[model samples]
Target: MRVEDSPLIDFIREEHRFSFGTFYFFDNFIISEINEGELFDWNKASEVIRVGQEFYGEEGQINYISNRIHDYAIKPQDWLRFLYERQLFKTFAVVTYRKTAIYNLVIERFFYKGDIFSFDSLLEAVNFIREQNALEPANDFDKLTQLYNDNSL
Candidate 1:
């Protein structure tokens, strides 16, 4: 499904725009749409993380969904920065139909150790998140925190 037609659109808690992209914060997930040709690096990642922390708290377990509605370049290595900083997401989902983006996702998997998935439509990604969320405990912050502490240090 298109981003505008997403099932979670009505549930967005807050919407924020940045020079590089737009972030739609939901109750337990974020849908990000970066601008075309923008280079997404650690600085951009930090901005998103800060907003997520502010909206969901430092210990909140949230999923991140990248709605690649535009062509963009991302530094896959920046996942290391997030790991080093102890900022983690429950899962990462990407919605893309582009071949280049699919190749990039493969490269990203080498650096990002967490669970990541890709979908051809926004609705598919959203459904995958819902399924994953259902399998997880309602309060999995402690589990995430412990995992971070154990692996990040």
Candidate 2:
């Protein structure tokens, strides 16, 4: 379900709209809905990071959710730049049912330094984020792998 249709909207503490997309900031996570047909590259990613810091502060550890409600082109390789800049996230979740998005996610995994989770539903993604305990390391590789394997996302 789209974020707007989910109860998630009630939790959004701040919202930012750009030409490329909209960002919904919550207590523990931020949901991004990029515009259709837009190219999501490093330049656009910079804006996201800047605004996110404005809300959550630079030291905050918030999970990320790419709520892909519309078709868009993303530079999966830009993840390298994201990592190179030393930015980190507790978890990165993608909400998309498209086969192509899943395939692209596979490519993104190679560049992303942290684990990425995929879910067909927005609620599932939010639940997964909520389950994460931010005080501890989120490197429970086996458990995380099992969860994704079970979902086949």
Best candidate, TM-score-wise?
2
Writing each residue's lDDT as its tens digit, candidate 2 over 88-136 gives 6878999987877787778788888788899888767766775674322
TM-scores for all predictions? 0.81, 0.82
Among all windows of 10 consecutive residues in model 1, the one with the lowest summed lDDT is 135-144
Tell me how far the alpha carbon of residue 116 in candidate 2 is from the true structure, in angstroms, after superposition: 0.5
Candidate 1: give the clashing pairs.
none
Q: lDDT of each prediction vs. the true structure?
A: 0.75, 0.76
Q: Residue 112 lDDT in model 1? A: 82
| Candidate 1 residue spans exceeding 4 A from truth | 5-7, 135-153
Model 2: per-residue Cα lDDT at residue 33: 93
Q: What are the C-alpha RMSDs, in order, of all predicted structures?
A: 9.0, 7.9
